[model samples]
Target: MQITKPTFYNEFSCIAGSCPDTCCAGWQIMIDQNSLKKYRHCKGAFRNRLLNDIDWKEHSFRQYQKRCAFLNEDNLCDIYSEAGKDMLCDTCRKYPRHIEEFEGLRELSLSLSCPEAARIFLSHKEKIIFRTVEKETPEETYDDFDYFLFTALMDTRDYLFSVIQDRSVPCALRRRKLLACGHDFQLCLDQNELFQWETIRTRHQNSAFGDSFQKKIFKWKDAEKSSDNLRKSIWKTIIPQMEILRSGWHDYLRDTLTPLYTSCDTEQQYQNVCLEFETFYPDWKIQEEQLLLYWIYTYFCGAIYDEQIFAKVKMAVVCTFMIHELAVGTWLLQQKQFSFPDLVSICYRFSRELEHSDQNLNKLEELLDWEEIFSLGNLLEI
Candidate 1:
């Protein structure tokens, strides 16, 4: 078996009481069957509290006003204090430590929705790197899985990593290259020509291939470079339609977005502000790279399942784009100053609202599929 994770994966440690927000809150904390049995068989005063806390019908913890029943005033888990870590359910124990499983591979990543994890990733100055290791297990068994396509996607993902992490290229051009690659591979995927993925991946990874692909992308994108209707429409029309996990998400968007796109918000004006904002806070290049890497490394390979590879890239692009916009809004709102802490706040809150929810993730994926503005070409309009 093989396991892969980010280099900073070990740096994640839950802040508990000092945490700005509790992971225990805002969503249904589902209990696994094994832990359910543990809770069912426990004895003593804590047992009664467990019985009260556990909603047998839903197999989830009860919540009082959106906060978990076990959450105390100090924002710590009562379950941990009373019964210890062993007594906690799988969801509680493994939280912020998300795993994506395949035939013989386990991809481990710290959920960026957690404040600490977000802070750790963003604070790291160097580029993120994936470390893979082999562990003894059963043979590489994949029943009815397209092992070929999976391997192809691995190559494609490596190609994308090269594109995004090529710091010598301007950040904007690198992002545009991502869209072009997605569109080309998606066309091949549609025509059942994934056999050609090697040629496709190699050309993209080759240094000389960037200029032509970029020229073609420039032809597809609008001439108005400073326009940002894509971000505006997504923020104004799409986001509100998704599941609202936390109470203040809408409010943050309102504060972050409304000011950026007011009644008289012209596209050029909006674009100019964003350009200025990005230019002033040049670190946005790195921050946006980290954010995109977070989404891609986590979801790109999983595309081999349904083969909606474009959708996965689209989701990452849209999410990263909007997060940068949110940062722009945040910068404007904060008298034109944005800091690392502000970024950490935005990253985690956005993840808490979008990444943590199944409904939201599916909804965004579905939207990215059919929405014209989210098209591979249009997304590069930025």
Candidate 2:
């Protein structure tokens, strides 16, 4: 078995009760079979409470207004403190950290859903290093797994990350390179010429990816104009969708976005938005880099097992970009004197809307098949 994780693995400990937002709330905690059986035959005074607390038919613990039933006013879990640490289900025991299994490999990443996890992920000072170690003994295996496809996927992911994390190229250029790489890799996979991956690797490293990208930008009949139009259209669609994620989201959207949302006719709106971001996040470039890094890191590694390469990449990019857009919306609201909770509320809500929805995921996957002229760098452009 091979285990892999980012270097920041040791830096996280659930803030638990003190968390500005509790993981115990706002999401379903699925109970595993073993835990369910134990809960069924429990012999303690808490057994009746357990039976009542769990939605046994649904195989999930009941939530109180989106929070777990066991959560106390102090945000602590009553079950664990009273029963023992091991008494909690798998979902309760391990959270914020998600494990994606691929054949003999386990890739670990912290979910951005947790505010504390988000802060830690976005605050990293160095390029994320993925460290892999083989267990002293081989671990369990799936009934049928494709090791060859997994290796090929791993290679392609490494190539994608190299393009994304390359600092010399402008962010837009890096994104374009990645998109191109994904396209070419898909082609190679279709032809079953995995051995020629070396050629793609070479082309990625010593190519004029940025120069060609800039040409593509200028060669378009009306590039900037089209971009402005796209930006307006995208935000118009996204803002409304974000409203469905949680309560008060519409208020946050209206308070933050409505005023500045139309303040500048397309021409100056971009500049105003840039200035707003600079005013709020200070060194926003570093954070943008972190976002790109995280998206590529999490999804790229997972592609090793699931050959749904394009879906994973598209999901990564869309999720990060949506979060960025939402943050901008929050910033726009804050400039109008909204509170931090307003922004945090918007973030959490937007996450739930996009992250939790099967329909939204399918929509994004479909959109990925469409022609794309804008890249992450273009989004970053002031």
Clashing residue pairs in candidate 2 are 256-333
- Minimum summed lDDT over a 10-residue window in model 2 is located at 373-382
Q: Per-residue lDDT tens digits of candidate 2, residues 247-299?
A: 56566556655545466567566667766675766544555566667667666
lDDT of 1 by residue, 1-382 (tens): 9999999899887788888888988899999999999999999889999998889999999999989999999999998999899998988888899998888889999888999988888887798899999999978676788888888888888878877888887778877777778888888989989888778767766743356766777779765533555566777657777888778777878888766677226776776887888888888889889888888898988887767788888877888888887888888888888888998998999898887788988888788878876766567776
Model 1 C-alpha lDDT versus the unseen true structure: 0.83
Give candidate 2 regions above 4 Å deviation: 190-196, 216-225, 235-245, 250-255, 304-306, 336-352, 356-363, 366-382
What C-alpha lDDT, on a 0 to 100 scale, does residue 135 get in candidate 2? 82
Kindly report which residue stretches of model 1 are placed more than 4 angstroms away from their true locations once superposed: 138-142, 207-210, 222-226, 263-267
Q: What lDDT does candidate 1 reach at residue 127? A: 81
At residue 69, candidate 1 shows an lDDT of 98
Please give the lDDT score at residue 86 for candidate 1: 93
**C-alpha lDDT of all candidate models, in order:** 0.83, 0.65
